[model samples]
Target: MKRVAILGGGPAGAFAAEQLASAGWQAVLFDEKLAWEKPCGGGLTYKAYSHYPFLLENSTPKRFVTETVLAAPRAGAVSLQLDQPLLIYSRFDLNRLLLDRAERAGAQIEQARVLEITRQGSRWRVLTNHGSADADFCIVATGARNPLREVGTQLTACDTMSALGYYVPGEQSMIDIQFLPRLEGYIWIFPRCSHLSVGICGKGEPAGALRKRLEQYMTEREIPWKHGSFYSHLLPSLHTASWRRNRVTGEGWLAVGDAAGLVDPITGEGLYYAIRSADLAVRALLSEVTGLAEKMNLYQRLLRRDFAGDLEFGSRLARRVFHGRFLWASVPARMVQFTRSSPRFSAIMRDLFAGRQSYLDLRQRLLKNLNGSLYEMWMSLGFRRLVPRKAA
Candidate 1:
């Protein structure tokens, strides 16, 4: 049996551990915290529902009215009410379930921080706070801003985008996505069980001012609330140019999940990619049966074929939306409504949302309707003498 080493006991690492263990491979997982609490928007988009059907059974899954309320400094506001519902749950509970499932699948997990990694001949050695470990293969799910900074990995730095959110009694259940012109990012409001999660994020140095501005926005809008005392942690905003350098599959090393820059950019969602990449990595390693290097090669190829388009498209979309006031203003709501109104558009949305098709599939559709899209986007942007910024 091949020995697999998984770094970080988050969703990505745990998923990989589970997949490998179920396939009879020995899997070991390590993380800094035995019980880590992730401070995310806590809203799981429908896009993730297909992969995590059991998310609704988490006992704390909060029922939020499935409507997207969008606001922008430029184009005012627009709301989207969908027949499909969206749900939110505590990140703490969600992660625990996955960890439990992985343990049940027979994967050994160690709550220790990995300090260093070295390669020797056909094996990789990982040094942790507790001790050292050797494995036939290594999976890096250390996330975007991991401090290890191993040489040869394609690393990128991102500006700090601040967010502070929490839940309080009598909070309304609505998913509000707000964009600020002064701030480079947006704020999100997601309902979680009895409490609500609300926070703001954006690029640039105005984050402190942005937070206060958000507080003011909430108060002015008469959104009844209190500023939760616990400060929200910083979320690393980066995606490496390349997930793997010399080779994805080396003598005995592989990269998966955020370490590989596989998160969805637009939604800031990484769980689905983490789980999907883990599944692919384990599947490939299992098929190898002997030559571990060959397994990594297959895993890399599969990930490229299956996810390259979405990753690229999402990055492009993220850049465009954040860099300008057009798309997030009123364009997104208008475009989504316009696209979903037609049967053809509905099918396309289904395929894309279901992950059955790549972003390339939607690209062609968008291109075919580029003229209409541009016109709608222009109208939504106010059509009042402002020029759309050139695409990056």
Candidate 2:
């Protein structure tokens, strides 16, 4: 039996272990904390659940949010009714669920921290604090803070975003997304089953600045964030050049999830990419490719064909979407306004929220519908002018 060592127990590692073990491969997964919370929204889009039905059919405690409110610096807010609701889960719960699935699939789950990984000819020797293990292959899924420097994406300071937030003891029916001025990222309030994950993520900005912005927003909205638990983490937001040279696989090893920097630069969405990359990695390893080099190439090709190319394009657009000026206003402000005034634009936004829209064709879609959107906005303004004013 071929032994596969997975150096993480997050969604990506756990999912890979499940697939490999089920295929009769001996899979061993190692993680210091098998299940833990993260400073993220932990929301899964329609594309995720549609691709993996088990995500939707599971008995896990989750929140299905169908409404989202988008706010910008001067655009106020616009309520959008989602055609496909977002499935929100606590990271700890989600990780536990994936880990449980791997265990049930015959994977050996070890609660240990990986100290180092050494290459021993065609095999790998994984050194953990608890013990040592040998494997025919290695899968790196230790997230953005991967301790194994020899494997995974080489992330520089510019290739990451600081994500920090509070798990507030509150509840709401809708998700709130607030776009700030001059920031490369946005703030989000995602309501889980029991609490709200109110967080801020920004690139090229200090964590202290991000936290202050989040606190001010919370204070203005009276969210009482001081009473909530604070958490912060790094999110991979690879630049265009970084994507071109991203090292996902080499020798007898492959990296998945954040370790591979398979994250959406614009939306800060990683869960879908994490799971999707793991699936592709396992498929490539189990393929009929005769050589290790061929298998690694296959994995790279699979990722590019699946979503890496799209994410790379998204990296180019991230700055424009956040900081660019549109129609004499900030891009985010214009987006909210367009969503309110134009039905065509609103539909596009809905598709984006559901993950049905791809960044590769976003410009074409917007350009194709720009005329209709403008006409709708003009007509909406004219209709409002025609309506009689309410009596004081």
Best by TM-score: 2
lDDT of 1 by residue, 96-120 (tens): 8778888999999899999988887
Q: For model 1, what is the C-alpha lDDT against the true structure? A: 0.64
Clashing pairs in 2: none
Name the candidate that leads on lDDT. 2
lDDT agreement with native, every candidate: 0.64, 0.95
Query: Which residue pairs overlap in candidate 1's backbone?
Result: 167-196, 185-202
Per-model TM against the reference:
0.79, 0.99
lDDT tens digits, residue span 93-119, model 2: 999999999999999999999999999
Candidate 1 clashes: the total is 2
